[model samples]
Target: MLDFINRVLGRESGGSKEIAKERLRLVLVHDRASVSPQLLQALKTDLIQVISKYMDIDEKAMEVTLDSNERQVALVASIPVKSMKRATRTPAVSI
Candidate 1:
């Protein structure tokens, strides 16, 4: 009832609690997945390799974790990029 009243009055009710609930939900889902730790680590390694093929990234600082809401699951990866290869511009050919 209080939440409904707050909503009607255009006030946010307990945003931090909601955020914490969502984060807890994600951690629970990740913890509950059936894959072995070794396999998950392998997957994370593969992710780093694939991403590093395109950009110079902070490999030592990368982190990969799983997350899920009620209906969807995701492999969340935090990769810090140190630098990116710039594309060289070709001289424009005038017709």
Candidate 2:
């Protein structure tokens, strides 16, 4: 990808350096949170199961990542919903 090429060539755009720094920070935050890849996968699976009860989602397109700042770590999910299901016994999630 273009990003790989740019990194290989040591070419940093005006904001790419900051973006790289933020990525490194996120890695450190994940380490501090003790969130392993397996744990993240497990969480993603749980989210899919729970959310699927009320909506049809594109599992292949779903993304779940951890974002952090100086004070807190946040779970960020980008799930593509195909359609919403009718009201059922399962409670709907509120943002």
Candidate 3:
């Protein structure tokens, strides 16, 4: 088989196909888990709120992502702490 020969030859091949396959595999995994990108965002927001109560965290920089592979939904959350500034503007008074 050509695929077998390519493998044995140690030549770089199938890169595009391999990348596409990997993407499809992850998409399928997310689909099966009933986890959507929106859901993942909501989860991330909630998680940040809960965790912030105990420690300082950077909600904007936080990354909560979902990936699917082979009927499995992987929820990945990366929370980092950083300096944040509070808004200075106050509510406008009616003239």
| Candidate number with greatest TM-score | 2
Error of 3 at 95 (Å): 58
Ranking of all candidate structures by their lDDT, best first? 2, 1, 3
The residue pairs in collision within model 2 are none
lDDT of 3: 0.74
Candidate 3, which segments miss by more than 4 Å at Cα? 1-10, 67-73, 83-95
lDDT of 1 by residue, 1-95 (tens): 99999999999878899889888886688678865668778988898888776678997898877877667888788989999746354547899
Position 76, candidate 2: lDDT = 92
lDDT measured at residue 72 in model 2 versus the true structure, 0 to 100: 76
Model 2 whole-model lDDT (C-alpha atoms)? 0.89
lDDT tens digits, residue span 1-95, model 2: 88888888998745767889888988988888888999999999999999998899999999998888768789999999999997767666699
- Candidate 3 lDDT over 1-95, as tens digits, reads 88889989998777898889888876777676777788887888789878765567877788876665455566778888764435344547899
Reference-based lDDT, each prediction? 0.80, 0.89, 0.74
* TM-scores of all predicted structures: 0.59, 0.71, 0.55
Evaluation by lDDT, superior candidate among 2 and 3: 2
Query: In terms of TM-score, how similar is model 2 to the real structure?
Result: 0.71
Under the 3 Å rule for N, CA and C atoms, how many clashes does model 1 have?
0
* Model 3 TM-score, 2 decimals: 0.55
Error of 2 at 25 (Å): 1.5
